[model samples]
Target: MRPGPSHLDTARAEIIVAEAGHRAAVDYVSRFGKWDARASVRQRPGRRLSGHRDELATPFPPELAPVAAHALVAGRGPDAVREVLTHSLYQYLHFTTELEELAVIPVVAKISRNRSGLDLPEAMRADAFKIYTDEAWHAQFSYDLVRQVERASGIAVRLPELPSFVERLDAVRASLDPAVRGLEALMFSIVSETLISSILADIPHDSRLPKAVRELVRDHAEDEGRHHAYFRQVLHAFWPALSARERRAVGPLLPQVVLAFLEPDYRAIGTALSAAGLAPDEVAQVMAESLPRRRVVDEVAGSAGSAVRYFTEVGALDDPATAEAFEASGLLLGAAR
Candidate 1:
C-alpha cells in the first residue's frame, strides 16, 4: 500500500518525538544524575592525573607517524578552531550514543541475572556499574565542552539530533544467539572501548583546551581501564566457545571496525587544520608527526596496558595467536620504540 507523503512525514515525526523524549530522559539522568539526588552526589573531587609526557620519547611507527607531524605543522587560529569544532562534534555524537546506551545497562544487567546464567563476579559487576556512571559523566562533559568551545571560538559544532548508533547496536542485539554473545562482548570491548580509550589518551595534556576538559579526559581514562578489564574477562570466558568458523569470521572484522572508528578523527583533524589557516602541506606534516604519538598514548592509557598486564597475570601471552595479533595490531608497539 502506498502511503501519502503527509502520512510518511507524520510517522517520521512520531519517531522523532519519541527519540527526543528518550534523549531528554538520558540527558536529564546523565547531566543531573539519578532521580534520587543523594545517590548522584559526588563524594570526592575527581583527581586530575597528568599523562605520560615521556611516552612521546618513543618514535612513532610508519602507520601512525604521519598524524603527529600533521598536527604539529598545522597553523593556529581559525583553522585550529575549526579542527577542534569538527573533532568535538564527532565526540559529542559518539559519547551521546554511549550515554544513552549505558543508561540501559542496569536493566540489561538485571535481565542477564534473571534470564541467563551470566553470573558476573562482584568486582566485575562493580566495574560495569562504574562504566555506566563514567559514560554518563563523559556525555555531560563532552556536551559542555562543545558548548564552551562554540562560545569561545564562535564555531558552531553540530550535535546529532537522532540516534544513529542505534542501527548498529540493534543489528548486534538481534544476532544474540548465545554462541555469538562472546563475539558481541568482544565487539564492544575491543572495537568501541579500546578504540575510544586510545583516542582519549592521545589527546595532548598540554593542548590549549580548558582545564575542565583535561580533567574530564583524565577521569574518564582511569575508568576506561576498569571497563577494558571487564570486557577482557568476558572475552576470556567466551574464548573456548568460539569455533574455528566463528574465529575466522571475527578476525578480519576487527581491523575494519578499528579503522572505521579512527577515520573520523582524521577527517576532524584535517578540517580543523584547514579552518585554522594552515597550508595543506603544513597540515599534512603535523598529522604525520603527531597522530602516531597520540595513538601510542591512547594505547598505554587505556586497554593495551591493562590487556598486557592481564596477559602476564593469566599467562595467556603464551598463546602464539594472541601474542602475534597484539603485536601486529601495534598494541605493544610503544610510540616510536
Candidate 2:
C-alpha cells in the first residue's frame, strides 16, 4: 500500500510526542526522584581520631611515607602548581583506568545477588552505573588534557600503567568475606573520593592550564561530592556491625594508601619537564621542592578534609594521642584556611 503525505505526517507527529515524553521523564528522574531522600539523610559521621592519631604518628620506613610533613609545608610557595598539574594529569589517566576496571566488582556482585532475590534500590543501581560512566569519561578527559598540553607546549608526557590498586582493593574485600563488604565499600568510597576531591579543589583557579581543563576538573569535583556523600552514608549505616579489629585495620590503611598514592615518580616528572624546555637539574630542583607541596594541597583539599570532618562527626578525634599524631602528620596545618 502506498502511504499518502497525511499518513507520513501522522507517523512523524507520534514519534515527536514520544521523544518529548521520554526526555521529560529523564529530566524528572534526574532532578527530583534521585534526590528526594538526600535531605532526610544526615551527613555521614566524621573519621575517628584516636586510632588514626596513633597510626599517623607511628614511625615507618622511609619508603612507606617518603615525603615529610615539614617538607610539604616548606615547599608551598614555589612553582608547585605547574609541576603538580603535569604530574597529576598523568596520574589521573592511570587511576581513571583502574576505577573503570573496579566498576565490574559491584556490577557482578549485584547481579549475582539479584538472581538470588536480593535487590538493590534502583536509585543506588543508577548511581553505580553513573560512576562507571564517569570513570571512563574522566580517563578520556585527562588523556585529552594531557594531549592538549603536549600539543600546546611541544612536550611529551608519557605515563606508565599504574599497578592495579583496584585489584588489590578487591583482594582485600574478598579476604574479609561478604558479610563485611560494607566496610570495604566505605574505605573505597571515603578514601578515594575524598582524596581526589580535595586535590581538585586545591588547584589554583588562576593556573596556566586552559579553561577547558579547569572546567573538566570543576565538573569532576561536583560529581565527587555526590560520591563522597554516598560512601559516608554507607559507612555510617554499617558502622554498628563492624568489629573493633575491622575498624582498627581501616584506620592505619587509610593514611597509608592515601600516602602511597601521593608518591610522585620523579623520573616521569623529569621526562615531562625536559620535554617542556627545562634542563634535567632544573626539573629535579622543582620536583624536590614543589612536588611535595602540591601533593599536600591535593590531599588536603580533596580527601583529607572530608576525612577529618568524618572523624570529627564520628567522635574519633577525641584522644590526645590522636590529636598529636594528626599534628605530627601535618595534614591539618593551615589546610582549611
Candidate 3:
C-alpha cells in the first residue's frame, strides 16, 4: 500500500498493459449498447411483459424476500406474498436508481474528466463516459419500471428517499479526514462496481419470476459485466498511484466501504413488513430470524470475494493495517487470500 516513486514505477508497468486493455473496451454506448438497440426503454409495449404472468403477478422471488418467507411460515396467504413482492420491487428500484445517481455516477464522471488523478489511457477515459451513459440509462429504466409496476399492481411505493447505503456512506465520510474524503469516495465506487450483486446475478435466470423482471434485470446484469471489468481495471490503475500516506489513510477503509454498500437496510425492511400488516413484534422476529448476524457477515464476505481479490492483487491488503481492518470487519474471515 506504500505510495512513492517505486510504487509509481510499478504502476507504470501495469499502466502499459492496462492501456491495451482499455483499448479493448469498446464504446459499448455507441456500438451495441442498450441505449441504441436493446435498452429496456426502447422495447415496444407489447414486448415488455411475458404473457405467462400478468403485471400484477409476483414481481419478485419469494425466497429473496425474507419478510415474505416469514409471512408464509406464519400461515399468511397469497395476499401477504403479493405485498412483500411489491415492496421488494419498490425497494430494489429505489436502491438501484438512487445508488447510481448519488454514489456511482459522480465517481465515474470524475474518471471521465480526468479528475480522479489516475494515469489511465484516453480509451479508459472515453469508456468512463460510456459507463456514465449506461448508468444513467439504468437509473432511468429502473425508475420507469417501478412506476409501471405501481400502476399495474395498484400498489404504492414505500421507500426511503435515499438508500440506506448513502446514510452509512455519510457516516464513513464523516469519520475520515476531510482531505481524503474524495479518495474514499473513489474507492467506494470501485468496491461497489466490482462486488457481485446477488440481484443482478440471479434475477435474470430465475424463470419463475415474471418476464419483465427477468428481462429488466438481465439487461442491467449484462451492462454490469462491462462496468465490473472497467472498475477492476480502474483499481489496478489507481492503487499503485497512491502515496504510502494516502494508502495508510484510505486502504483500511475498503472493507468498511464494502459493508456500507452491501449491508441490508433492516430499518427499511422492517417498515415495509409493518406496512404489509406484520405486527411490530412480528417484524422484529422476522428480521432477526431471516437476517441473523452471522448470515449477514458470511454474505458480505462471500459477495466481496472478487473485490477483495482486486485489493490483494494490487497490494492494498499487503499493508498490515489494511489486512487487520478487513479481518476485524469480518469480510475476510474465510476469503481466499
Candidate 4:
C-alpha cells in the first residue's frame, strides 16, 4: 500500500528554508561548550556526605522512589538507607548514561549520514557530531563515577546483564507499527534526553552529595542544557517533514515511549535493594509498595509534561488518535489507569 502525502509536504520547502539556520543552537554550543568531564575536574576526597547527609537519600523525590517506604527498610537505620538510595543513584545513572551512547548517538548519526533525511543546515549537522562526542564523554564519566563510588563505598554494583530501559525501549519499538518503528527509537531517546537534562541540572546543586558527585553531575548538566535545547530544535524542525500518516503512527507512541523511559525497572530496583542487604521477599515487597501504578503515573506524567507540551505545540497532538493515546497513557485529561 502506498503512504499518503506528508502532513507537512505542502509546507516542507518553506519549513526547511525557515529552519535551516538552527543558528541559536550553533551559537550556544560554540560559546558555552566548556569542560571535559574526564579531564576538567580534579580529584576529591570522594566524601559521601554533601555537607551533613547524602543528597542521594532523596534521589528523584520522596514520593517517587521512596526507598524508605517499607516498614522494615525504613527502620534499616540511616546508614543502610543511604546505601540503598546511593545504589539506586548509581544504577539509575548508569542506565541513563548507557542510553545516551547506545540510543541518542545513533539518532544524530541518522541525520549526519544523510543530508536529505535530515534536511537540516550544515551547522546543525556539525552540531550533531558535537552532540555525539559530548554524549560519549558523558557515558565515560558516568562509568568512571560508578566505579569510583563502588571502590570507595565497597558496594559492588551488581546490575542485571542489560539495563531494563534498553529492554523496555526494544519492547516499545517492537510494539510500534512497522511504518513508524524506526521513528520510535529516535523519538524515545530524544524524549529521555529531556528528562535526564532536568535531573542533571539540579543534582549538582545538592550539597548533601559528595563533592566529586556534584561536580560530575554539574559537568554533565552543563552539556545537557545545550542538548536539551538542541533536541527541542530538532523536534521543531523535524515534525513538519513527517506525513500525516507518519504523525498518526508516531504520535500515539509518544506516551508509550515516555512511560517506558520514566518508569524505573522494579526488578533492577529489587536487585539493587537486595544487594544492599534486604532479602528477596523484602525487596519484592518494597518494590511492590513503593511504585504503585498511580504513583508511577503521577511521577511519570509530571516529569513528562514539558515533552508532552512540546509535542502538542509542534502539532503532533493535532490528531485524535494521538490525543487519545496521550489521554490513555495518563498524559492528557482523564487518562487511563
Candidate 5:
C-alpha cells in the first residue's frame, strides 16, 4: 500500500534536510576542521600560565556539580576544587572518546555496511565516513589533552569502572531483550552525540580554564556541531525504518542513556571528595543535603531535553512501556500526553 501524504511529505523533507546537512559537514571539514594536533598547537599558541592562583577554576559547569562547591568539598580550597574539577573533566572527556570509539563509530559503520548502498544512501554513507574519521581524531586529541593537563598540573588521574557510560549502558542492555540490544546501543550513542552538542558551549568559553584546554574543547565542539546535524538527520531516517516493538524498546533506553551521561557519578564524586580530604560523614551529608537529587534530575532532563523530544516525535514515547520506563528512571515524569 502507498504511504499517506504525510508520510510522503516527511520523507521528502528528510531527503532535503539530509542533503543540506551532508553538504554542511563537508564544508566544515574542508573549511575549518583541524586534522592535526601539532598544527592546532602551532596555530593556537602561547598557552603559558600566569602566576595567579585565582586564574584556575572549575572546568565543567558548576551548576552540574553543586555538591562540589558546597563547604564539604570546595572548603578544602582552590587546589582541592581544581583537583576534583580536573578529575571530573578528565574522566568525562575520556568517556566521551571511548563512547565515540566503541559505541558510535561502530554503529554507524555497521549500519552503513549492512544496509545496501541504496538503502543507506550515498550522502549519509559519505558523511558517516567523514564522521568516523573525525571522531577518531577527536578521541586521539582528547587523550593527548589529558596527558598535557596531567603533566602541567601534576595531578594523576584515575576513575572507577562500573558507572562509566559504556558500563552503565551495558548493564541496561543486559536487562533488555537480546534482539533490541543493538538498538539500545545505537540510541544511547545518539544521546551521547546530542548531549555533547549542548555542552560544547559550557567548557570552551570558561576563561578560568587554560587557553589550550579551552581551545581543545572549542575545536571539538565545532566538529561535533557538524556531527550533531548529521545524526539528527540520521534520526530522521532511522525511526521510520523500525518496527513498532523496536521503537518501544528504544524508548525505555533513552532516559537511561541521558542519565548515564548527564547524571553526576556520586561514586566518583564521593571518591574525589575523599581524595580532597573530606570526612566520610561530610561526603554523605553533602550528597544528601547540599545537592538535591530532584534538582540533578531536572538538570539532566534539561541537558538531554532535545534528544527526549526527538524520541517522542519518533513515536518512542507513545508506547506505554517506554513511558513507564522513563518515569521509573526518574528522568521524565508526566511527559506522556
Candidate 6:
C-alpha cells in the first residue's frame, strides 16, 4: 500500500466524480490497480533479515508512543520492544482479517450481488467486486506477514481471539432498535473505510521498521486510499436511498461507529504491555499516563474529521439528534472542519 502521487490523483478523481453525481471515476483497481504488479500475495515478497541476529531490528515504530512509550519505561531492551511490535502486528492482522471477513465482506457481497437495498449503479457494483478481491488480498497478505514476522522474531504472538473493536461493534448493533438493526454493518463498513487512520498514513514513511513490514503497510495504505474514496461514493449513493425514518435511526449511531474503529483498545494495549515485562502496576501507570482521556479524544477526533465531514456533506448531521450525538461524543472537538 505504498501510496504515491498516482493514488492521490485517483482519490481526487473519485471525489470529483462522486460530488458531481456518484458517477464512476477512472477505476483504480481495474485501470491502475497494483494487484498484478505489486500486491504482496501476488508478488510473494519475502522477509529480508540479517541472519546473524534472530531478533527483529525494530518490529514496530518506536516513535509511535503509548506502546513505544511503555516499552521505554519498562527498560527491558529489545525483548520489550519485540513484544510490543509483535503484538501491534497481531492486532493489525486481526483488524485486517476480521474486518474483511466479518464486517466488510458481508456488506460488500450484498452490494456486489445487487442484493443490498440501495440502488447502486452497475459500475459501483462492479467496483464492489474488485473491493472484495482487494480486501481478500489484504487479509491474505496480512496473515502471511504475521506468520513471517513471528518466525523471524521468534516471539509468540499474543492477541485477543476477537479484537475489541468487533466486540464493541457487536454491542452497538445489539443496542440498536430492530427496525434499524439491518443498517449496523452497512453504516459501520462505511465508517471503517472512510475514516483516515494515521497508522496507515504514517507507517510506510517510517524508516526504522523492517522493509517487509513497511512495504506491507505501504501497500495496505495505498489500497485503503482508494477504498476511502470508493466508500465516500457508496455513502453518497446510500444516504439518498434511506428513508427519513431510517436516516433518523441510523444517524445518531455515527459517533459510536467512528469510535468503534478509532478508539484505543486499552485492554489489548495493557496485555501487550504486560507481555513486555512491565509489572501490572507499571502497566497501569503507563496506560493512564500515555493515553489520557484528552489524548485519546484528540486522536480519535483527528482521524475521524474527514468521515464526520462526509456525513455532514451527506446531511447525516442535519438531524438534531445526530448533531447532538456527535457533540456529546466530543468527536467534533477541535476536529478540522
Top-lDDT structure, candidate number: 3
Model 1: CA > 4 A from native: 1-41, 44-130, 158-182, 190-209, 251-264, 277-305, 308-328, 332-337
Ranked by TM-score, top first: 3, 6, 4, 5, 2, 1
Off by over 4 Å in 4: 1-64, 196-198, 333-337
Clashes of 1: 33
Regions of candidate 3 where Cα sits further than 4 Å from its true position:
1-47, 50-53, 71-74
The segments of candidate 2 whose C-alpha lies over 4 angstroms from its true place after superposition are 1-88, 92-122, 147-153, 163-186, 196-199, 202-208, 262-267, 274-284, 291-303, 315-328, 332-337
Instruction: Go through the candidates in order and give the C-alpha RMSD of each one to the true structure.
Output: 14.1, 16.8, 5.5, 6.3, 6.8, 6.9
Roughly what TM-score does model 5 have, to 2 decimal places? 0.78
Give the TM-score of each candidate. Answer: 0.52, 0.55, 0.85, 0.80, 0.78, 0.85
lDDT of each: 0.43, 0.44, 0.74, 0.65, 0.63, 0.74
Model 6 misplaced regions, further than 4 Å: 1-55, 334-337
Model 2 C-alpha lDDT per residue in residues 1-337, reported as the tens digit of each score: 0111111221121111221121101110122234334311221221122222222222111221232222442255223334434444555555555554554335424422432111223444445555555555555565565565545533245555543454456665665545434555545644565454433564326344344545566656655666666555433322322344444445444444444344344555565455445656666665676556666545444446666566545544454554555555555543353
TM-score, cand. 6 vs. native: 0.85
All candidates in order of lDDT, best leading: 3, 6, 4, 5, 2, 1
Which tens-of-lDDT digit does each residue in 45-128 have in candidate 3? 322553444655668877677667774334677776787778888888888898899889998898789677665555666768
In model 3, the clashing pairs are 3-243, 3-244
Question: Each candidate: how many clashes?
Answer: 33, 16, 2, 5, 0, 5
Worst 10 residues of 4 by lDDT: 22-31
Which lDDT value does model 5 have at 187? Answer: 69
Q: Which ten contiguous residues of candidate 5 have the minimum total lDDT?
A: 1-10
